[model samples]
Target: MSPRRSRKTSFEDKMARLEAIVEELEKGGLELEKAISLFKEGTKLVEELSEMLRDAEIEIENLYSEDDLNGD
Candidate 1:
């Protein structure tokens, strides 16, 4: 039998794009047109991802920082 997959599919990719967009905006070098477009895209991506997270909850395994991986 195949192992079942976990983690939100494409979730990390969307987050990466959003981070890039914010970085571009913060750089303050983009032309107004490009900045506005990136801002719009970033807002949309944030909303979509927020909705995805809102629909579910998952226990995080904070193995790197805390013992027992958190509030288990």
Candidate 2:
């Protein structure tokens, strides 16, 4: 996926695509080039998804820390 398209795509959509790629790879019989292409895309999606999760975790932590500071 292009960087622009990926930026617009939601995390759930990327995860679904990654799952589909894994299923296809697992099933076998893909041409070597196609399989490699799918593998690259899957890895890219994994990186993007991991970053998104990390960002969310940081945001949540910050929110809770702010609450603690406020004695809420």
Candidate 3:
């Protein structure tokens, strides 16, 4: 993959990439180096998505608290 393609990768995009990775792994055609790199990238994607979700949840909770405090 190109550097630009790798940089803009998102949760959904990475999930799709990971699905392709799985299919490739299942098909047993990728070289060891490529497979390892894909696995590492997929791990990064999982962590990135998890952190994004945690931040989103915190924001949602804060918004709810603010609404309650405002007597809305």
Candidate 4:
């Protein structure tokens, strides 16, 4: 069998995929197994995206802190 498509690492791509999953779930036609799989994948995407945002926030804070020290 062919390999599964790789999950994206970028935050935007993850968000897009998560949104698509949500839309698919909302449409109400998926089999029980498929819905469970999508839900699990969506949960993972949310966790990864949350981590990315947290890292970005920390980076932004560090940049501002440096600017404050430099009187910028």
Candidate 5:
């Protein structure tokens, strides 16, 4: 599979998981260890999401630059 396709799939999956994590956290009756673990996972997801967004933004910019170069 193409890297782009995989990344898109991963992004979607990560977002869904993150939402689930947030919902679970919000319900708030878990053991302290479990809550902390969920928080850590959520934090990691946020970082990954941010990085993916940055990479996408850069790709978009590059595409526009290429278009300009081609006089499109």
Candidate 6:
């Protein structure tokens, strides 16, 4: 297992890590325990990424509404 991480990372960094995990999983040589662990981590990253995108969508909608109100 990898050492625990203490520092905060950006969304892009998380995405990159997720991508690496996916590539590793796709190669298909990991033991069951390791595969399960990677799968769990990847799932969590996906949830976080989804939430971030959802929040961004809401922000964009708000900006459009404000622009409409101001006749921009």
Each prediction's RMSD to truth: 10.7, 7.4, 7.8, 9.0, 5.2, 9.1
Residue-level lDDT of model 5, residues 20-50, one tens digit each, is 9999999999999999999999999999999
Tens-place lDDT per residue, model 3, 3-69, is 7767556657867876776777778878999989878877787777677567453333365677588
Please rank every candidate by lDDT, starting with the best.
5, 2, 6, 1, 4, 3
State residue 3's C-alpha deviation in candidate 5, in Å.
3.2
Residue 67 of candidate 4: its Cα lDDT? 61
Worst 10 residues of 2 by lDDT: 55-64
Candidate 6 deviation (Cα RMSD): 9.1
Q: Which pairs of residues collide in model 2?
A: none
Candidate 1 local lDDT, 1-72, one digit each (tens)? 332333444678789999999988998988999999999999999998998779566778645666545745
Q: What is the C-alpha local distance difference test score of each model?
A: 0.82, 0.88, 0.73, 0.82, 0.91, 0.83
Q: Candidate 5: what lDDT?
A: 0.91
Q: If both were scored by TM-score, which would come out higher, candidate 3 or candidate 5?
A: 5
What is the C-alpha lDDT profile of model 2 across 1-72, one tens digit per residue?
Answer: 898786667777998999999999999999999999999999999998898777453333355676688896
Compared with the true structure, the alpha-carbon lDDT of candidate 6 equals: 0.83
**Least well predicted 10-residue stretch by lDDT in candidate 4:** 1-10
Backbone clash pairs for candidate 1 read none
Please identify which of the two predictions, 3 or 4, would achieve the higher TM-score against the true structure: 4
lDDT of model 4, residue 69 = 82
| Top of the candidates by lDDT | 5
Clashing residue pairs found in predicted model 4: none
Cα-based lDDT at residue 45, candidate 5: 99
Q: After superposition, how far is residue 54 of candidate 5 from its true place, in Å?
A: 2.2
Model 4 per-residue lDDT at 70 = 88
lDDT for model 2, please: 0.88
